[model samples]
Target: MDAVPLLRISRPHRLSEEVGAVLEKHIRSGEFGPGEKLPAEARLAEQFAVSRAVVREAIARLKADGLLESRQGSGVYVAQCLGAGVFRMAAGVRGEAHPIEDIFELRLIIEVAAAERAALRRTPADVEAIEAALARMDEAVALSADGVRADDDFHCAIASASGNPLIGRFVAFVSHEFSASRAPTWSREGIVRGLAGAAQDEHRAVHAAIVAGDPAAARRAARQHLLRAARRLGVVLAAPPGARGEDMDEETS
Candidate 1:
């Protein structure tokens, strides 16, 4: 078999991401098989000539992406099926070849419905999780892009709150696709500078609608939020028949 090329890390920046790229390439290239245990953290650190923290971060990211799993007191092994489809989508975003707007469109369809359902179906535990995620989002917003994990957690909690296992799993599957793509689009610099506070206010609307068990309100808020995101990303809206530029503006407005 041909050798899999490794990513060359010339500059010492984001060692964890670089490490993840290297390991992901190897895994995709079949250098590592599913259910196979990864080398110990110390060995991986030595191989990459970086500290264990870097390796740990890389592994954490992979685990989050569902590419790997770890059992306490055991070892980290590749997850069954390895979720190559999700990985490819994430890789496309990372390469900047994927259209971020299109992904947002897909997210709009999935999340709006999910939010509506969650509002109707959420149990006490689901409400608690959603509130916790909202708190995290508030904290992240105050801190700017530093709140990526919290923002992500909020969405995941929403998925779970929907009370549909399939929906939650699907959302979790595509969650990482927006990590790099949507983060820059919704961060403090992005939202505050671009939307002039509309973005934050829109999120609040969605949260409130969900909490109130108002499905229609939730759907509307979710659609408006994603539409704003699509506009910010420069996505061209496909106008319906007899719909002019003014109509499009009115619809979005």
Candidate 2:
């Protein structure tokens, strides 16, 4: 029964995700109190200026997050007790002190092990998924686009290939959190071009190690790629444990 906030949907991000974020914010702010019924789907669609399908997807995301519940033959209502708090990563804005280094450190911990496991466990299907994502990234680069979605997909594919569903889910969450910082638009044109090309080369190295079923090589390549990526964004992560001199040497080589 609370007033819905105005939403201005932007490009280059999924509509459902944007809508879901708005709804989540209102719920967390207590504007939409616990146990209160939400507006009808049609009303929500009209309010958000999106189709019913988009509204549906946004609501579904909330349900999955355990922030809402549905009763048979009754409208959706906010959950009486908020379950586990939703995890989020805000887009790093210029001039604001964000923990960019800490984020990359988390990625190094998650993705390095993921790449190693993927190399050992990936099937032909998983390889194809990773390859397809890379092809999309290459095409986006050729068109001078940022390729953020494809880049996200590439990392998610690698995580899924690890054969641990939980790892795959965590990687997707991490990618979403870090995606805003990955866009090259704030940099000069020359730098954007150089970063895109260099990033592609690094991605291919990881792919090559996975295809060869070389676990150690894959771990090294994934770790090196993330480190270089962080530097591109002006972040320097503290060295995680187990990164020995030999491994660092191999990464540079």
Candidate 3:
């Protein structure tokens, strides 16, 4: 019944994200405390000067982030626990100039270790899945596509093969967070070909080491691939723990 402070969205791109951020800020600031019901979707949409569909998307994202919950025959309310103890990509991180670079640093920590375990624990079927994802990437590259999904699938396969479900989940989460970062890099026409080609080669190196069941080599390969990926995006990652601090000369296929 009181006046709402939701601002009208001006930018067209990533409408849902903007709306979600506004609502999340309110929640975090205690304006919408735990168990407090939010305004109806239609009302929120009108306040934001956006469609109901956009409001729905924003709500869904908040739900996924554990900031909100729904009740049967009732509207959405702020979550009671507010995702306590859960690992979340902070809102500030996503707003940074190279947010994905920070995520890449996380991947270097999680995925490099996962790749080593995958080489040790992967079964024949796991190898098949990894190869299948690799094939899809190859097809996308040959067709001059960005292959972002295929690239994600390739890393996820290795995560699955790690024999640790927690590692798999964390890898998938970080990968999702960093996905938007790839679009800009691929959107550039002049470098897409070279970038995709180099990426594919690095992927092959990782796959080869895993297929050979060589844990140390797999670790090395995975680290090199992620480091090279950051380079392709014009990002420089500070060497994470256990990294050999390899230079550009060492990132060969």
| All-Cα superposition RMSD per candidate | 14.0, 14.3, 14.8
Candidate 1 residue lDDT tens string, 153-209: 567677788999788767766676655556775566775674424556767787888
Tens-digit per-residue lDDT, 144-229, candidate 2: 76688788888889999999988976775456565655666223472455888888889999999999999999998898888888
Order by lDDT, highest first: 2, 3, 1
* Candidate 3 lDDT by residue in tens digits, 185-211: 344461454777787788899999999
Computed on alpha carbons, the lDDT of every model, listed in order, comes to 0.74, 0.81, 0.79
List runs of model 2 lying over 4 Å from the truth: 1-62, 66-85, 90-98, 185-193, 247-253
The per-residue C-alpha lDDT of model 1 at residue 80 equals 54
Task: State, as a TM-score between 0 and 1, how close model 3 is to the true structure.
Answer: 0.60
Q: TM per model? A: 0.60, 0.62, 0.60
Tell how far residue 105 is off in model 1, in angstroms: 1.4
Superposed by TM-score, candidate 2 places the C-alpha of residue 237 at a distance from the truth, in angstroms, of: 2.3
Greater lDDT among 1 and 3 belongs to 3
Q: Cα miss at 192, model 3 (Å)?
A: 4.1
